[model samples]
Target: MDKFDKKILTALHENARISYAELARRVNLSAPAVADRVEKLEHAGVITGYHARINPAKIGYPIQGLIELTVKHQDYYIVMEQLGTMPEILECFSVTGTSGLLLKVAVHSMPDLQALIARLMQYGDTKTSIVIDVPVPLRMPEVVETE
Candidate 1:
Protein backbone atom coordinates (compact mmCIF):
# COMPACT_ATOMS: atom_id res chain seq x y z
CA MET A 1 0.00 0.00 0.00
CA ASP A 2 1.08 3.58 -0.64
CA LYS A 3 1.42 6.42 1.90
CA PHE A 4 -2.06 7.72 1.08
CA ASP A 5 -3.54 4.25 1.53
CA LYS A 6 -1.81 3.94 4.88
CA LYS A 7 -3.20 7.30 5.99
CA ILE A 8 -6.73 6.25 4.98
CA LEU A 9 -6.38 3.03 6.97
CA THR A 10 -5.06 4.89 10.02
CA ALA A 11 -7.95 7.32 9.85
CA LEU A 12 -10.51 4.53 9.48
CA HIS A 13 -8.92 2.57 12.33
CA GLU A 14 -9.53 5.60 14.54
CA ASN A 15 -13.12 6.04 13.35
CA ALA A 16 -14.76 3.72 10.83
CA ARG A 17 -17.81 5.89 10.28
CA ILE A 18 -15.85 8.94 9.09
CA SER A 19 -17.40 10.63 6.06
CA TYR A 20 -15.68 10.40 2.68
CA ALA A 21 -15.33 14.21 2.68
CA GLU A 22 -13.67 14.20 6.08
CA LEU A 23 -11.45 11.31 5.09
CA ALA A 24 -10.57 13.13 1.88
CA ARG A 25 -9.68 16.25 3.88
CA ARG A 26 -7.48 14.21 6.23
CA VAL A 27 -5.79 12.42 3.33
CA ASN A 28 -5.63 15.47 1.02
CA LEU A 29 -7.58 13.71 -1.72
CA SER A 30 -10.89 14.31 -3.47
CA ALA A 31 -13.95 12.60 -1.98
CA PRO A 32 -14.31 10.33 -5.03
CA ALA A 33 -10.62 9.42 -4.95
CA VAL A 34 -10.84 8.59 -1.22
CA ALA A 35 -13.92 6.43 -1.82
CA ASP A 36 -12.15 4.59 -4.64
CA ARG A 37 -9.14 3.88 -2.45
CA VAL A 38 -11.33 2.63 0.39
CA GLU A 39 -13.26 0.39 -2.03
CA LYS A 40 -9.98 -0.99 -3.38
CA LEU A 41 -8.73 -1.61 0.16
CA GLU A 42 -11.93 -3.47 0.98
CA HIS A 43 -11.73 -5.57 -2.21
CA ALA A 44 -8.05 -6.35 -1.54
CA GLY A 45 -8.94 -7.64 1.94
CA VAL A 46 -6.69 -5.08 3.66
CA ILE A 47 -9.80 -3.47 5.12
CA THR A 48 -12.04 -6.12 6.61
CA GLY A 49 -15.19 -5.05 8.45
CA TYR A 50 -16.41 -2.21 10.64
CA HIS A 51 -18.04 -2.65 14.04
CA ALA A 52 -19.10 -0.88 17.21
CA ARG A 53 -17.23 -1.52 20.43
CA ILE A 54 -19.62 -2.16 23.32
CA ASN A 55 -19.18 -2.65 27.02
CA PRO A 56 -20.36 -6.06 28.22
CA ALA A 57 -21.33 -4.71 31.64
CA LYS A 58 -23.62 -2.10 30.11
CA ILE A 59 -25.52 -4.86 28.31
CA GLY A 60 -26.21 -7.11 31.31
CA TYR A 61 -23.00 -9.14 31.28
CA PRO A 62 -20.85 -7.90 34.17
CA ILE A 63 -18.20 -10.63 34.37
CA GLN A 64 -15.56 -11.48 31.79
CA GLY A 65 -12.98 -14.24 31.86
CA LEU A 66 -10.55 -16.29 29.82
CA ILE A 67 -10.95 -20.04 29.57
CA GLU A 68 -8.23 -22.41 28.40
CA LEU A 69 -9.21 -25.85 27.23
CA THR A 70 -7.13 -29.00 26.83
CA VAL A 71 -8.99 -31.03 24.28
CA LYS A 72 -8.21 -34.43 22.75
CA HIS A 73 -6.97 -34.33 19.17
CA GLN A 74 -10.01 -36.21 17.89
CA ASP A 75 -12.44 -33.91 19.71
CA TYR A 76 -10.93 -30.62 18.52
CA TYR A 77 -13.28 -30.04 15.59
CA ILE A 78 -16.25 -31.16 17.62
CA VAL A 79 -15.43 -28.63 20.32
CA MET A 80 -14.90 -25.89 17.72
CA GLU A 81 -18.34 -26.50 16.21
CA GLN A 82 -19.91 -26.48 19.66
CA LEU A 83 -18.17 -23.24 20.56
CA GLY A 84 -19.92 -21.51 17.66
CA THR A 85 -23.27 -22.28 19.27
CA MET A 86 -22.31 -20.73 22.58
CA PRO A 87 -23.07 -16.99 22.63
CA GLU A 88 -21.21 -16.42 25.89
CA ILE A 89 -17.92 -17.04 24.06
CA LEU A 90 -16.68 -13.66 22.88
CA GLU A 91 -13.62 -15.02 21.10
CA CYS A 92 -11.70 -18.25 20.68
CA PHE A 93 -8.18 -18.93 19.47
CA SER A 94 -6.08 -21.98 18.72
CA VAL A 95 -2.64 -21.41 20.13
CA THR A 96 0.63 -23.34 20.43
CA GLY A 97 0.78 -24.53 24.03
CA THR A 98 -0.39 -27.26 26.41
CA SER A 99 -3.94 -25.96 25.94
CA GLY A 100 -5.52 -26.52 22.55
CA LEU A 101 -7.92 -23.57 22.76
CA LEU A 102 -8.26 -20.25 24.55
CA LEU A 103 -11.61 -18.51 24.95
CA LYS A 104 -12.64 -15.03 26.09
CA VAL A 105 -16.07 -15.20 27.68
CA ALA A 106 -18.59 -12.99 29.44
CA VAL A 107 -21.36 -13.86 31.85
CA HIS A 108 -24.09 -12.31 34.01
CA SER A 109 -22.85 -13.66 37.33
CA MET A 110 -20.51 -16.05 39.14
CA PRO A 111 -23.13 -18.79 39.05
CA ASP A 112 -23.47 -18.32 35.30
CA LEU A 113 -19.72 -18.65 34.90
CA GLN A 114 -19.78 -21.80 36.98
CA ALA A 115 -22.58 -23.20 34.84
CA LEU A 116 -20.69 -22.35 31.64
CA ILE A 117 -17.63 -24.09 33.04
CA ALA A 118 -19.69 -27.14 33.87
CA ARG A 119 -20.87 -27.31 30.26
CA LEU A 120 -17.34 -26.78 28.85
CA MET A 121 -15.90 -29.46 31.16
CA GLN A 122 -17.80 -32.05 29.11
CA TYR A 123 -15.51 -31.20 26.17
CA GLY A 124 -12.16 -31.12 28.04
CA ASP A 125 -10.28 -29.86 31.05
CA THR A 126 -10.82 -26.12 31.51
CA LYS A 127 -8.94 -23.41 33.36
CA THR A 128 -10.72 -20.10 33.86
CA SER A 129 -9.41 -16.72 35.00
CA ILE A 130 -11.96 -13.94 35.65
CA VAL A 131 -11.00 -10.44 34.66
CA ILE A 132 -10.88 -8.00 37.59
CA ASP A 133 -9.82 -4.95 35.59
CA VAL A 134 -8.92 -4.13 32.02
CA PRO A 135 -5.66 -2.23 32.03
CA VAL A 136 -5.60 -2.47 28.23
CA PRO A 137 -8.59 -3.45 26.12
CA LEU A 138 -8.83 -4.31 22.43
CA ARG A 139 -6.87 -2.11 20.04
CA MET A 140 -5.81 -2.21 16.39
CA PRO A 141 -2.33 -1.70 14.97
CA GLU A 142 -1.71 1.71 13.45
CA VAL A 143 -1.06 1.57 9.72
CA VAL A 144 2.48 2.70 8.87
CA GLU A 145 4.28 2.80 5.56
CA THR A 146 6.81 0.01 5.09
CA GLU A 147 10.15 0.51 3.40
Candidate 2:
Protein backbone atom coordinates (compact mmCIF):
# COMPACT_ATOMS: atom_id res chain seq x y z
CA MET A 1 0.00 0.00 0.00
CA ASP A 2 1.07 3.57 -0.69
CA LYS A 3 1.18 6.51 1.71
CA PHE A 4 -2.27 7.61 0.55
CA ASP A 5 -3.63 4.15 1.19
CA LYS A 6 -2.04 4.08 4.62
CA LYS A 7 -3.64 7.45 5.39
CA ILE A 8 -7.00 6.14 4.24
CA LEU A 9 -6.71 3.07 6.49
CA THR A 10 -5.60 5.17 9.47
CA ALA A 11 -8.58 7.46 9.00
CA LEU A 12 -11.01 4.54 8.73
CA HIS A 13 -9.45 2.88 11.76
CA GLU A 14 -10.08 6.07 13.75
CA ASN A 15 -13.61 6.61 12.46
CA ALA A 16 -15.10 3.88 10.32
CA ARG A 17 -18.16 6.00 9.53
CA ILE A 18 -16.26 9.07 8.31
CA SER A 19 -17.74 10.67 5.19
CA TYR A 20 -15.92 10.54 1.87
CA ALA A 21 -15.61 14.32 1.78
CA GLU A 22 -14.13 14.45 5.27
CA LEU A 23 -11.81 11.58 4.55
CA ALA A 24 -10.67 13.20 1.33
CA ARG A 25 -10.07 16.50 3.15
CA ARG A 26 -7.89 14.70 5.70
CA VAL A 27 -5.98 12.88 2.96
CA ASN A 28 -5.91 15.72 0.37
CA LEU A 29 -7.91 13.82 -2.24
CA SER A 30 -11.22 14.19 -4.08
CA ALA A 31 -14.33 12.46 -2.69
CA PRO A 32 -14.54 10.05 -5.61
CA ALA A 33 -10.87 9.15 -5.28
CA VAL A 34 -11.38 8.45 -1.58
CA ALA A 35 -14.34 6.21 -2.39
CA ASP A 36 -12.33 4.29 -5.00
CA ARG A 37 -9.41 3.74 -2.63
CA VAL A 38 -11.74 2.51 0.15
CA GLU A 39 -13.35 0.05 -2.27
CA LYS A 40 -9.95 -1.25 -3.33
CA LEU A 41 -8.95 -1.60 0.29
CA GLU A 42 -12.03 -3.71 0.94
CA HIS A 43 -11.44 -5.83 -2.17
CA ALA A 44 -7.83 -6.38 -1.10
CA GLY A 45 -9.04 -7.49 2.35
CA VAL A 46 -7.21 -4.67 4.17
CA ILE A 47 -10.48 -3.27 5.41
CA THR A 48 -12.39 -6.24 6.75
CA GLY A 49 -15.71 -4.68 7.81
CA TYR A 50 -17.26 -1.91 9.89
CA HIS A 51 -19.09 -2.35 13.16
CA ALA A 52 -20.78 -0.33 15.89
CA ARG A 53 -18.97 -0.28 19.22
CA ILE A 54 -21.74 -0.75 21.74
CA ASN A 55 -21.43 -0.66 25.50
CA PRO A 56 -22.61 -4.03 26.80
CA ALA A 57 -23.96 -2.58 30.05
CA LYS A 58 -26.09 0.00 28.22
CA ILE A 59 -27.88 -2.85 26.44
CA GLY A 60 -28.73 -4.74 29.69
CA TYR A 61 -25.59 -6.84 29.66
CA PRO A 62 -23.89 -5.62 32.82
CA ILE A 63 -21.37 -8.37 33.21
CA GLN A 64 -18.20 -8.69 31.16
CA GLY A 65 -15.55 -11.39 31.59
CA LEU A 66 -12.55 -13.21 30.15
CA ILE A 67 -12.29 -16.99 30.15
CA GLU A 68 -9.34 -19.31 29.67
CA LEU A 69 -10.22 -22.81 28.58
CA THR A 70 -8.28 -26.07 28.45
CA VAL A 71 -10.08 -28.63 26.35
CA LYS A 72 -9.50 -32.22 25.29
CA HIS A 73 -7.32 -32.23 22.15
CA GLN A 74 -9.83 -34.49 20.36
CA ASP A 75 -12.78 -32.22 21.23
CA TYR A 76 -11.17 -28.96 20.08
CA TYR A 77 -13.13 -28.39 16.89
CA ILE A 78 -16.37 -29.55 18.52
CA VAL A 79 -15.92 -27.07 21.38
CA MET A 80 -15.04 -24.24 18.99
CA GLU A 81 -18.23 -24.89 17.00
CA GLN A 82 -20.28 -24.98 20.20
CA LEU A 83 -18.77 -21.66 21.30
CA GLY A 84 -19.77 -20.10 17.97
CA THR A 85 -23.42 -20.85 18.75
CA MET A 86 -23.26 -19.16 22.14
CA PRO A 87 -24.09 -15.46 22.01
CA GLU A 88 -22.66 -14.84 25.44
CA ILE A 89 -19.22 -15.74 24.14
CA LEU A 90 -18.57 -12.59 22.12
CA GLU A 91 -15.01 -13.48 21.11
CA CYS A 92 -12.80 -16.55 21.21
CA PHE A 93 -9.22 -17.13 20.17
CA SER A 94 -7.09 -20.24 20.01
CA VAL A 95 -3.82 -19.00 21.44
CA THR A 96 -0.40 -20.46 22.19
CA GLY A 97 0.50 -22.12 25.53
CA THR A 98 -1.18 -24.55 27.89
CA SER A 99 -4.66 -23.06 27.44
CA GLY A 100 -6.57 -24.00 24.33
CA LEU A 101 -8.79 -20.93 24.08
CA LEU A 102 -9.29 -17.44 25.40
CA LEU A 103 -12.77 -15.93 25.43
CA LYS A 104 -14.47 -12.63 25.98
CA VAL A 105 -17.99 -13.06 27.37
CA ALA A 106 -20.87 -10.80 28.31
CA VAL A 107 -24.05 -11.38 30.32
CA HIS A 108 -26.92 -9.56 31.97
CA SER A 109 -26.13 -10.74 35.48
CA MET A 110 -23.91 -12.87 37.63
CA PRO A 111 -26.50 -15.66 37.56
CA ASP A 112 -26.45 -15.60 33.75
CA LEU A 113 -22.68 -15.76 33.75
CA GLN A 114 -22.82 -18.65 36.20
CA ALA A 115 -25.18 -20.65 34.01
CA LEU A 116 -23.07 -19.95 30.96
CA ILE A 117 -19.94 -21.03 32.78
CA ALA A 118 -21.64 -24.25 33.89
CA ARG A 119 -22.33 -25.18 30.25
CA LEU A 120 -18.79 -24.26 29.20
CA MET A 121 -17.31 -26.35 32.01
CA GLN A 122 -18.72 -29.52 30.43
CA TYR A 123 -16.22 -29.15 27.57
CA GLY A 124 -13.09 -28.33 29.59
CA ASP A 125 -11.35 -26.73 32.54
CA THR A 126 -12.10 -22.99 32.76
CA LYS A 127 -10.64 -19.95 34.54
CA THR A 128 -12.81 -16.82 34.51
CA SER A 129 -12.39 -13.23 35.62
CA ILE A 130 -15.21 -10.66 35.76
CA VAL A 131 -14.41 -7.13 34.62
CA ILE A 132 -15.62 -4.45 37.00
CA ASP A 133 -14.43 -1.49 34.97
CA VAL A 134 -12.56 -0.67 31.79
CA PRO A 135 -10.34 2.40 31.97
CA VAL A 136 -9.38 2.29 28.29
CA PRO A 137 -11.52 -0.37 26.61
CA LEU A 138 -10.84 -1.20 22.96
CA ARG A 139 -8.49 0.76 20.72
CA MET A 140 -7.36 1.08 17.11
CA PRO A 141 -3.90 -0.01 16.04
CA GLU A 142 -1.30 2.33 14.60
CA VAL A 143 -0.41 1.25 11.08
CA VAL A 144 3.00 2.24 9.75
CA GLU A 145 3.44 1.54 6.08
CA THR A 146 6.83 0.09 5.16
CA GLU A 147 8.88 1.10 2.15
Report lDDT per candidate.
Answer: 0.94, 0.92
lDDT of 1 by residue, 1-147 (tens): 889998998899889999999999999999999999999999999988998888999999999999999999999999999999999999999988999899999999999999999999999999999999999876667666664
Estimate, for each residue in 25-45, the C-alpha lDDT of model 2 and write its tens digit. Answer: 999999999999999989989
Which number leads on TM-score? 1
Worst 10 residues of 2 by lDDT: 138-147
Query: Residue pairs in steric clash, candidate 2?
Result: none
Off by over 4 Å in 2: none
The TM-scores, one per candidate, come to 0.94, 0.94
User: What are the runs in model 1 whose C-alpha is more than 4 Å off?
Assistant: 144-147
Alpha-carbon lDDT of model 2:
0.92
Angstrom error of the Cα, residue 84, model 1: value is: 0.4
Q: Could you give me the TM-score of model 2 versus the true structure?
A: 0.94
lDDT value, candidate 1, whole model: 0.94
